[model samples]
Target chain A: MTASGGPAVRLVTGTVLDADGAPVAGASVHLADGPVPLPDIAALTGPDGRFSFPVGADGVYTVACRTADGRGARAAVAVGPAGAPPVELRPG
Target chain B: MTNGPHTAVSNQPVEITAPAAEQAVFEGPSEGAQGGSPAAFTSDGLEQVAGHTRALSESVPAEAWTAPSAPLPDIGEASFGPPDMLETVHGPDDRVQITDTAAYPWRVNASLLITAADNSQWIGTGWFIGPHTLVTAGHVVHIKHSGVPGRDGWVKSIQVMPGRNGTFLPFGAVTSTNFRSVTGWTADGDENFDYGAIVIPTELGAVTGWFGFGSWPDADLLKTSVNISGYPGDQPPGTQWYDGRGVSSVNPLKVFYDIDTAGGQSGSAVYRIHNGGRYGIAVHAYGGLTTNSGTRITKAVFDNLVLWKA
Candidate 1:
């Protein structure tokens, strides 16, 4: 709605832990909004820690992750359009 | 030393490097494998599509797009989404740092078109809709008349650029239209009726102004958090936001926003906040929505739509 570079509204979620913290079952969580980028927008986490994406009209996000025994993490969050304010996952 | 075939291809200065999100749905060339002109992949076609994408980026190793196990949900503790952490850490020569702000302003917008066999390129996501109507995703701008089997798409010329690092702001003077299939219709390039409506003469707030469309919200905006902007030509381009969590639900025609969209994001505009206000609908068209394949599944007149002032 204003995404080609700037104007507040960016939402991108994550959560799929393992390696001491627990919570990693049948993972398939993905999110990409740029042309050709893909984690493949997936969702399969329902033991408790949720996953959602109504996505931005706000801005600032750069989140990345790779699990299922791959072990990876990248972080940055700034979603604002009056939403996106809860995300917590610990364990390298 | 050099000044012949236009100074030897302009003294060999080709090193643009800014289009990698996985080819963003392959723009610029390859319209049905052409036999003549349709090979715009200079730099030797990016070195033969980077040697056919280096064995598919070394056998699917974007870390395999992650997910071994992690869908948290245990009582006494709660998790919404996005927490296994890893949001932009590219460094293995993929090189991603991105930090140039004099006025970032959230910046990141996109809308492309050039097809119907006329040198391939269909990437969308630019919905202003009135001010010169510009909505996207009818397969990224109509295209289905070749060999005519069902046909329901055709419009090649609609450019509304804003950002993706090259920092653009002027490019809008093209229009195309087609969206009148509201029956038991099944398949005709069915991207779930992959919506499309661009009638731009000039007025998307003249550049950026207008956003609001809702209906599929019955309850549970899943994870209830959002934000997703488009315009991707990775390696630190302009706009590419993400913070997913709206894992598929509430389906009348379509509504799935795990964020993550490519091919320039079909016709992106999936925001949330409903009830109190703050809507921004038009959730990911064709970039992702494969519950089936015969897409065109429409039915939401809602009085021609224009609601978002509550």
Candidate 2:
């Protein structure tokens, strides 16, 4: 799916890290749940282990991430219409 | 757009949808609490047509409706199931991505990125059952609860990408506004009735091929392993993921299984293969820690689907 436009589009961004805090790339990241409809599909971490989702409403959304080999982690963060602060995830 | 004598409803609501702009443009959903008229007929009229259609359909074997373009290679037998599948807890993130998405079966599974009535964008999944017909979770086409006031009605639109591999669209994508669901879901938001359908403006399924679905008996379902493959939001974006396990349990309306999945996979096909033929048993919806479930294909649902296929 293509990205939505307009400068007002707020985003919930973060990076997936290992237990030691090193950036973990290629991990799958998802939102546990959010307002009525979340945008697009889940995010896949880039080489820098970062992922982002476009958000519009305010609520607590879980940034759940998992590695190709089964390691995973999740963080629940409060968000606003403007978006949430960047979160850091560490999969064990 | 009006229909012939067989239907009277106008076509689905459209909003300057290009072949594929995705979420680039936003538009309000069809006005009113009532959704846009169904692609075909109203429930009353559909049932009437189904009466005659069902009689003719029953005579034909399920596989004849739509077979794959050619035989498909084994898309994995799964980590759990009969004879010796080592039935165990299904958590290990073992789902494999399908790069051969241009092939049959895989191509039939479409990734659904949806825009609800509230204009909130979300992700889900869908599968082609006919040249133009798609079966999906009711929630994908219509939002429920939502807490978003009057926006809990039909979705605004859907970007259907069949055989999508990450950003690569082997079959491209189509944005559809036409959709179908029962009163149990649209009116009451009943969890037990969370099944729906979509009809694309084009006959994409004809080239992609489609799956046949039927209401199998409980006894048969218990012995079979249901296969699930869809675009889960947690995975690589737009890529299809798969997992399969034996039916954990079943009721008259729901079929429970151990298929591993997360959000964005709400409408994947829960199918069982018999004699190498794939037929959908359910429309995958709810996902849990240990299990995922779907709306089973019952006789009544079968009839409704037959009519909706038009």
lDDT of 2 by residue, B206-289 (tens): 777777788788888875767777887666567777666567677778787766677678788898765445678888876432
Worst 10 residues of 1 chain B by lDDT: B25-34
Across residues B1-310, which tens digit of lDDT does each residue of candidate 1 receive?
A: 2211111100113412222222111011111111223212222112111212221232355456431221111210122232232222121222122222111222223444333333232334555533454445544544432222332234335555533334433333354432222111112333334444455444433334344444434354433434345543221223443333333443445444334343344455555444433334444543322210112112242212221000
Query: Per-prediction RMSD in angstroms?
Result: 21.7, 15.7
Candidate that would win on TM-score: 2
**Residue B296, model 1, lDDT:** 19
Q: Candidate 2, B81: how far from true, in Å?
A: 28
Model 1 compared with the native: what TM-score?
0.27
Error of 1 at B24 (Å): 30
Give the TM-score, chain B only, in order for the candidates. 0.25, 0.71
Q: Each candidate's lDDT (Cα)?
A: 0.35, 0.63
lDDT of 1 at B80: 22
